[model samples]
Target: MDVDGEERIAAPREVVWHALNDPEILRQCIPGCQSLEKTSPTELVTTVRIKIGPVGATFNGEITLSNINAPESYTISGEGKGGIAGFGKGAADVVLIEDGDETILRYAAKAQVGGKLAQLGSRLIDSASRKLAQQFFADFNAAVAADGQT
Candidate 1:
């Protein structure tokens, strides 16, 4: 599956960039994220719970950031196993553009699933993925806005 979208944040590009790289911020923004720990500057260990169709599982994963260009852009990739529920792996390219005082964040991602998740059908998985992505950006925008006001 392929998913891509853009969001406009009411903050400076630098601030948006910082939030994107911050594990605490990501932990709060990611839907069903149980934990996200930075194992290294470019790697993170994560646990997330997800429910799709009739399958619910907790996935342990490692997310890696590469081709990083600081406050501009980077590529992130990860894979997780959800026991018998299945497995998922994906990669995303994220870019940040400064629009005066605001920031425009854009991403293009590709994902694949195997096992029970794939059996659930592409429509269901795509819908769930899109909803999760939207929720993450909404939460992230709110968090960044709140932080700026403080």
Candidate 2:
């Protein structure tokens, strides 16, 4: 499945870009993220707990940032394994455009899932995916915006 959207964050592009790379900020922004450890400048290992429908699972994943353009844009990719629950892999192309004092954060993401998670039906999975994405960006936007205020 694919999902895309944009958020207007009340912060400069540089601030938003820095927040995107901060493990602490990302851990707080991501829904269900249990832990996020930065292993390298562009790589992180994470654990996230999520429930879709009635199946609840903990996913261990690795995230990588590439195609970086510094304070501008980058591609974020990750894959997670949830044991019997399923496996998921996805990539997102994120672009940060400066809009005066704020930043317009746009993303195009593609994802795929297998195992029990896929058996849940496409409609359900798609809906859940969109909701999760929205939640993450909303939280991220708020966090960055609040930080800018201080």
Candidate 3:
């Protein structure tokens, strides 16, 4: 499944980029994310509880950041396993563009599923993924805006 979206944050590219790399900020922004640990400058490990339709599970995931261009663009690869629930692996290409006092964050992401999660089909998976992504960004924007850090 594939999902993409763009959000305009009322903050400079640098500030937005910094927030993106902060595990504390990410832990708060990610929907259902109970914990996030920055094991290194380019790797993050996360634990999240998810509810899709009637199925609920906890996912443990690792996200790796690469192709860094400072406060410009980067690529992220993530993989998660939910035991009997299923597993998912995906990668995203993210570009942050400067828009005066704001930043335009664009992303293109794709994922592959296995186990029970794969039985749900692409439509359901795509919809859920898009909603989760949207919620994360909205929370992130709100957090940064609240701090007046952007």
Candidate 4:
């Protein structure tokens, strides 16, 4: 599945960029995230719990950042294994554009799933994916805006 969207954050591009790279910030913004740890400058390990349809699973994943251009754009990719529930892998190209005092964050993403997740049907998976992405961005926006105010 493919998803594309943008968010206007009430912070500068540099602040948004730093927040995006901060594992603590990411853990707070990502729905269902149990833990997120940065193991390297360009990599992180994460655990998240999620339910798709009737299947609930805990996913352990490694996320990598590539093609990075500081305060500008990068490609973020990851693969998660959920035991029998399924496996999910996806990549997103994210860009941070300056919009006066705020930042316009844009992303284009593609994802694939296997095992029980794929058996659940594309429509359900797509809807769930979109919802999760929206929730993440909303949380991220709030977190960054609040930080800027402090």
Q: So what's the TM-score on candidate 4?
A: 0.99
Number of the top TM-score candidate: 4
Question: How many clashes in each structure?
Answer: 0, 0, 0, 0
Off by over 4 Å in 1: none
| Model 3 weakest lDDT span, ten residues long | 141-150
Off by over 4 Å in 4: none
Model 2 weakest 10-residue run by lDDT:
141-150
Candidate 3 per-residue lDDT, tens place, 1-150, comes to 778889999888888898888898889999999999999999999999997766678999999999999899999999999999899899999999999999999999989988788888778887888889989999999987875642
lDDT of candidates 1 onward, in order: 0.96, 0.94, 0.89, 0.96
Candidate 2: tens digits of C-alpha lDDT, residues 6-104: 889889999999999999999998999999999999999999999999778999999999999999999999999999999999999999999999999
Two-way lDDT contest, 1 vs 2, winner: 1
Q: Show pairs that collide, candidate 4.
A: none
The better-scoring model by TM-score among 1 and 2 is 1
- Ranking 2 against 4 by TM-score, winner: 4
User: How well does candidate 3 match the true structure in TM-score terms?
Assistant: 0.96
